[model samples]
Target: MKKITWLLLLVLLTATIHLPAQRKADRKTLENLQAHITYLASDKLEGRRTGSPGEELAAGYIAGQMKQAGLAPKGDNGYLQTFTVWEGRETGEASQLTINDASFAAGEQFVPLPFSAEKPAKGDVLPAVKEPDNIWLIDVQDMELNPHAPATDKYLEKAKEAAENHASGVIFFNGKEDIGAVRQWLREKPAPLSIPAVWVNRDVSRKLDGDNASGFRISMQVAFQQGKRTGTNVIGYIDNGAPNTIILGAHYDHLGYGEDHNSLAKGEKAIHNGADDNASGTAALLELGRMLKNGRFKNNNFILAAFSGEELGLFGSKYFTAHAPVDLERVNFMINMDMVGRLDAAKGLQVGGIGTSPSWTPLLRESAEDMQMHFDSSGVGPSDHTSFYRQQIPVLFLFTGTHADYHKPTDDADKINYDGELSVIKLVYRLIEKANKQDKLMFLPTKETQVSSARFTVTLGIMPDYTYSKGGVRVDGISDGKPAQKAGLAAGDVIMQLGKQPVSNLETYMQALAAFKKGDKTTVTVQRGTQQQTFNIQF
Candidate 1:
């Protein structure tokens, strides 16, 4: 009885005493993460929009934080690695419209379309047709172009027909009441389109004779310029007396003031605080950096990089990989954190790039212990990790998952699940520790999985699971009220055939979707387990 009591006491002591130390460390880490997110996602930062003053503020704050945390400045400049991007926008004065004899004011009576060229254009206005040699005009006063669904069926059809027929450009006739919406929409598309395009109000439209529309000469001058905006990537290098380098990165940029085209909300403009989108990831990176500063590692020096311009494109990461502060060849592995704020502990965290190295799967599994996790074998994903992965370096991407507030103005700091995110960060920290102790991770090229960033004329509104390495595209998510959802397409449905085309991969799927137009009826075949089901989709 005495021996049994002693054994029970020892077991209880191990559970109570030994684990509290880890818990205390984790609590401090969580606090650090929260502090970072609070500042980065704050409204004063104005959504951390790339190229904006807000983004510069964020970069400055990050650098200061890193300095305070005792991180060695690894950036070309002191805690700042600068890169330039071709940022262009419509200059208010140069963007003007003159239809017939009436001159229209910019951003009011008339505004250039998102796809319009910056150069001056004067051409005869004609009705849209199969092949329009002159500028095509489309009147959308009677059509329903909702704020959410701005690209109506008729609008898309017209655009597609014009593009297909090799039309020079298009002019849309929107009423004066919709000027604000039009401006909001145009602001989203910062770059020029295939051909020059413009939008004029009905007041200007009234000036044109319906019978002799070809008689009207529309003169438009939309000016845009490419200038360099300087931003920094806050980098910290930890010297562990090891020759091998391991990089950990996260993009700190977000869509500022819903000005960028990526924002989902329309009409009313607000600051798109990208808390979960990336501030979360940036926070995780900071916390990891702080821990690693004092943590023990047998081998591998660490590079903690907080990148900018990820919202613009993968510009920051791409530049970093190209102009690597450290040798790229010696990089043992890379870990990227993006959108890790809203972790659902039950559904488990997702770890991508498992197939980037042969040892990744086993290493992740061994380090994860009983933590709930979904392992994805793809190296290519929409994050900073892909940049390193492309350079033949092993990578692991941590994502908490997408939410309704993704890329929207409503994605604020208050929505972050701190405890859940802390759990995810802890898991990643453990994995990194394990990786550093092991032999240099061998980089393995994963099978080419086509990621669908394709622009399509029509879509069934299904989010394809790019990580699924299968013969057919798997429908991981069905967008609500979309054609696929209305057609009885559910999540987990593996799309085998779209129309008559065999949907072999994401590329083929895009081709099939592009072949369709709105209101066109097509049969979609999906393999749900052993059964093949056919459903009709009206796009």
Candidate 2:
């Protein structure tokens, strides 16, 4: 048995010595890349939105392709790793409101607020008045609200103030103008309150306008149902019976109808077919999987991954890293391709994470024949590769740079440069083959991507969950010796207030950080579960 194992290794090593030329980068490969991108970026796929049916179709296609390519399933469930995108909340159709013996529909005439408590309420609705345990009718004559203190002006805050006034329920309506904008925000998923709340439309508002002094009997039920969707990551493995494994990954998800507010397109809604944004990378991944399936490079195993929910803050990759299919220690390094379709000889192909390992530059320089390559030292960037880098694994991220079509409906499949993308896939294959004979790549940490984007001198040293849609930024990580860590900030702490400014999202957090200079002191307020805690800290 020992002799047989050594002989097999010798055969594999001998094949390495012979250095069989990798599959030729030719017309067939370019055609294959074009076909994959065209299908993935088609209108039928609906831009491959994460957790949507369109994304499910793309996942199935990729899985089938992997099966046909003869790669074994390395995921938890047959070449697919599924994870929850979000557990949002929405008002059920059963929710209704009635006043003065008149019925109002749940969606058309009236709608329940997202944060409202799901409870039935029966009481007399009085206009412009607040009393103990009775519904108060607020006339939609725009209340003079402080712009700077929007937290106090929001519906949730007003509901809390009404609770303090001992109101059983609150009903809002517009008397002076249309409340269409107000009704548009009737979404669930926020933190619910103890009292039920509903907003009445123009028709209902006109009926309730006569009763400044008269009392109207009200009956209401606000039912909120949880909404969830599962996002799948397609994984394919080439088992060479080697010790360490190499990961080549790209995210396949893109904006569908620009619903997430990340789209740069304005006007009427249209599908943000991210052909160059991600279909390019995903197609490249498929081609690379096929290229490596042959018994050419056998020193290390390979995992080809097409991630989902990348546009939604790298959720798919993060989940994959947390619940890795193989022992993380056996992983060699990760190579990520994203938006690599628009390569220009003049601008060059951008190659980041060069500083992740000492051998990366030398290997990259040796591998390049006539390709124009650009480099960055940071191992962390705005891509799926950043997830592996965070796990202490060396990583490389490839891109062709952003264009006018970025994050917009104009980014259609026809706009993709198939030849440029084929070159990228070929480059990734060469890199992997070059490192097949060497030992596992050594990992070295470098400055994060935000260092170049967010320019602030003061350090809070907290990692906020950029994907968090809930009210304020939630702490996902805390760095040692930073202001937040020293001030008792912990992971899961939702930062509500930063000094004098309110920290809402990543943008607001950066804005709040801009006010403070080095050595400045301020108070930071965070929501720790049911409790809101404040801490004093120095920059």
Candidate 3:
């Protein structure tokens, strides 16, 4: 019986195995890239929004492509690395606001701000004063009084001032003439602020400042529901019998129905078909996978990844790094392709994170024959590559620069430059082959991408490296004509202290920034190498 079982197992294994000659790769061509982008950016997918059905559909398509390319599944479940995402929700119908003896209806007399804290809290309704725990009234007349000054700037200034004064909440008084504007704002989603705020109509505002008002208790019940969404990151691998591994990634998600505010074509509601934004990158990734599967590369394994939720703050890539299928220590480097569809033969390509590895420049130069290449040393940028960079892995980000159709409904498949994308794919393929033949690329630390949700009325106009994880926030880039530049602060300066607060990371820096109002002067201490430099900045 044992001999018979062994014989049966051997027969099954032999039957399943295919000869090398029998395994063939499909031809990689411009037509393939065009077809992939056309389907991904089609109107039927509804913009492939993160946490939406459209994104799930895109993920499924990518997994199918990888399977067809003879690539093994490298994800936790087959070819999908599924995860959850929490999104902001609309106000519930039971939510209401009551001030003084009269009860005001929501969406009529008043509406809560987007970033307002949601909780059941009651406090004494005091007049608009420059003190804590008071519902400050900001008249809309004062906000829009100067049309030339810009209403948004003025409102932000006033809000910042009120926040600095420790006002618990703000009640924007929308007069009869400006009620329409308030209504529009109520419909729009606002970023969550440090404090709760609301918009009250003229009738409600009159009651707050009326002579009959005695003691008042302001009550608000705003609740937010925590939701879980399942998203996938299509992952596959090309085994080359090498210890070192290389990662090639692209995101497949985009804004859905213009809800994320990334849409360039505002006002009119339409599908934000992200053909150039990411479908182009994804197509390049697919084509590369097909090319690599042909066994043309010399050494080093390859990881082909199509990530979802990049539009929603790089959630998919971040999740993959945390739960990677392969050992991160063996990774040679990461190459990311994002927005590579609209490459102009004359304009060339903008390659960021070139400074990440010392070998990248020489390798790129050696491979370039008729390509125009521009490079940036900063390893930190807005893309999936940043996730790998944050993990202390060297990365290269390829982009063709932004266009008028970026993040807009007009970003359709028909607008993609197929030949341009094909050229980029070919260049990358050659670079990969070169990299595979060499030793594992050295990983070097570069400036990190500073990202935060904290709001500020004033800025130092300097970009901080959030992934530094050191004692101080390192300045990576400084905007010209900004306060930091005027104060003589330069990149590579580590901010040890902001005003009186010790800066540790991006969050602490934001907290320190909130302490200073516009026009306030403070001393900034920066660690420039072994020396601690101090400069006075006015914000």
Candidate 4:
């Protein structure tokens, strides 16, 4: 009896000691998640803008983390999926026009609109004719100086009408006072046409008012180019001998300069350190990769990808979908992590893409129930998952939601909710485990889908695949918008036909667009829920 009692006591002690260690291990995982967030969100990365050296540095750091996590190279030559982009610039050269004998300099008198294939007018000589429908050349100063100066909207309206009427180009004479402002505006706004638009100083316009001014004419030219600049995507994978793959992605790029609204700072100043914007997401992906690599959960193949150039309009994700390392069809599902570090502790977590796949709701529901996690289940919206959704792949996007500091310089690492992020990571792991145990891949239909963007429009929200050779856009998701809400278009509706045209692709859809202007209505037909439907859209 004494020996048996001693053995029992030993077992009790072991249980007591092991319980705390298990808790400690869980705590350490959470700590590591926070550490990764802090380092990646630091200012040292300089925002990780596309094509910048800072971005390269961030990529290198991420690749190192993946390597340390025991992930194998799933990208070209080790870890980078490279591509190119076209960068644009402006040439500061004055364009002048001579109408009859009247001549104008660049900023002093006129501006040219873009998409003008050639200069519309050239040479000298002509007289004023006030025919109601006849084209007439007039100076900018002449219009501005008039007692009843028309509003800008009115001017554009008249211009559009004039263009429709095939009127000759307008000659704008620059006033000395507003010359600087005019030049600045012209430099920023794309020209309306290649029509012979010219800028002449007040003195020059006055000089041309002399006798024999009939020698007036107009001339102009523009110079530009399209070239390639290199960019890259980092991909890492862990194979668990599963038939289907699970993809986790995040874009590692931010706006390079403070020009657009998405820029982190005001004015043309400050480095856009996109810490919470995405470094947070990328960091989470790294940590998740580490956990999966070390954990005993075995089954589905895991692909972790850090994409470049998302700021320039989801370019990286789009590229990845088009040229995937693995068979895209074999991808069981995709989970996109963007801006996950800044969870609003007060509100808990707001999860999107819950309705994207039938499996998403059930899987997430089970995990949340088991863990008692605080989660809000909204549907998918903008971000990289739209690209995969276009390919008919099921996707779930993870985000903490937008904040006051979003896209601002204040969005630094210090502001992240490390504890909240820990909770989210734990939840994600549970969901992955649940997904891997499923009997078969879930193939959800594209109908009545929900999207956060589009101002809650009840129409089929289909994101077009720009890379598709077919003219019309490849449908990504049909949001629970009007037509889609009523007719039922889900997350994988591919629009192949609209009205009478064979929208065999996106290009054809554009060609069909030329048939209708804003306010004009048309019937749009699309393939969704494995059925064809024609819906009328009033644009």
TM-score winner among the candidates? 2
Candidate 2 error regions (>4 Å): 1-25, 87-95, 98-115, 123-134, 139-141, 145-166, 174-194, 199-218, 223-227, 451-459, 466-497, 500-520, 525-539
- Can you rank all candidates by TM-score, best first? 2, 1, 4, 3
* TM-score per candidate: 0.68, 0.80, 0.66, 0.67
On residues 34-147, what C-alpha lDDT tens digit does candidate 4 reach at each position? 676566656676767777777788788888989988999998869888877643322235445554455555434544432222344443335554233333455444554433
After superposition, the stretches of candidate 3 with alpha carbons farther than 4 Å from their true spots are: 1-28, 86-111, 114-220, 225-230, 447-539
Local distance difference test, each candidate: 0.77, 0.81, 0.77, 0.63
Model 4: lowest-lDDT 10 consecutive positions = 181-190
Q: What C-alpha RMSD separates each model from the true structure?
A: 10.2, 7.3, 11.3, 8.2
What is the total number of backbone clashes in candidate 2? Answer: 0
Model 3 agreement with the true structure over 1-539: per-residue lDDT tens digits: 99999999998777667443223322346778878999999988899988788888888899999999898999988998887764434444666778756787765677665446665546786554445766567776656556433244455566667767877766666544344344333322334556666667778878766777665677766544433467789999988888888899999999978765666675767999899989999999998988889757747888999998788667788788889888998998999999999988889999988878998998899777799999888787778887788777889999998999987888989988887888788789878878877899887776443343446777787766533434577886675677888999998899988998767555467768877778999989999999999999998
Q: Write the per-residue lDDT of candidate 1 for residues 443-523, one digit (tens) a residue.
A: 987643434444666768775654443457788556567888899998789988999877765646776787777789999
- Cα deviation of 48, candidate 3, in Å: 1.6
> Can you list the residue pairs that collide in candidate 3?
115-192, 115-193, 519-539
Regions more than 4 Å wrong, model 4: 1-35, 85-112, 118-220, 227-230, 260-269, 369-380, 446-481, 484-539
